[model samples]
Target: MSALDPSVAGQLAEDLPPDVFRTIIATFEEDLTRLVQELQTAHESGDQNGYERAAHSLAGASAAVGAVGLEREARIAMDHRQPEAAATVLPRLVAEAKGALEALHALIH
Candidate 1:
């Protein structure tokens, strides 16, 4: 799947005022960065609850911004039952977040 859904991005751009859309994208960027860090820390510390919470929040934020790939990865991370499983998925999740951020940034600039 694409990192960002073009239709969703287009709709967001077309529906909101430019400044509002820019603010949304900026907020999403900040949330994405913070959540990714939370994911990493939770995984390393074996904090399953924190990890899942971060993943869940990340998924929702990603979906809000039409970051399909990141949303998918975040879901996977959220569903992982073991911290060991996270080891395999965390890298992909982080990469997806990076791609999503890049795509979202492209929307405004």
Candidate 2:
């Protein structure tokens, strides 16, 4: 599957003004970076609650932006009850986020 759902993104772009859409995309990028960092730190620190919280936040944000792959990965991360389990999925989650961001950026530019 694609990192982003183009139809959903296209709809969003069509519904919002150019500047507003750009702002949302920019905010998503910034939030994605911060959430991914939080996920990493939580994993490294063995903070399962923090890891799950970050994953949940990421999933929600990704969904809003039509970042399907990232949202899927984030949901998977959220499902993990243990830090070690979440750690296994961290790389995939990060990769998906990167791909999603790229796709989202393409929509605005």
Candidate 3:
């Protein structure tokens, strides 16, 4: 996990167990929370790149976990150069990410 890119989900999942994935989901959930917080900061600071990076990460992770809703939200987020434009999409991403995590947990355990 150390040598490989943490951004790729397949490699991220290679060593982690189902329970660990759930734990990972928990961590991601926190990350998402922090992401939104950072979005607020970025928007206030007019940091377009910050917003984009976070959205891009969200898109990749959502796609990896089969979270179509989150992926959609993330795409919407990444599409806009302005965080205000992507603001509404964040909740959907959170919901979808949660759903995808739940589904994976069910299938795994």
Q: For model 3, what is the error of residue 105's alpha carbon versus the real structure, in angstroms, after optimal superposition? A: 5.1
Every model's TM-score: 0.91, 0.91, 0.61
For model 1, residues 22-68, the per-residue Cα lDDT tens digits are 99998998898899999999989999899999999999998888899
Candidate 3 per-residue lDDT over residues 1-109, each given as its tens digit:
0211234444556667877877876776676677767766776688888977777877776666555666777777777654555556666656666666555445444
TM-score of 2: 0.91
On the 0 to 100 scale, the lDDT of residue 30 in model 2 is 91
True-structure lDDT of candidate 2: 0.87
- What lDDT tens digits, residue by residue, belong to model 2 across residues 1-109? 8898877888898899989999999899899889999999988999989988999999999999889998988998888654547657888988898888788778874
What is the C-alpha local distance difference test score of each model? 0.87, 0.87, 0.64
- Write down the worst ten-residue block by lDDT for model 3: 1-10
| Candidate no. 3 TM-score | 0.61
Off by over 4 Å in 3: 1-16, 81-84, 101-108
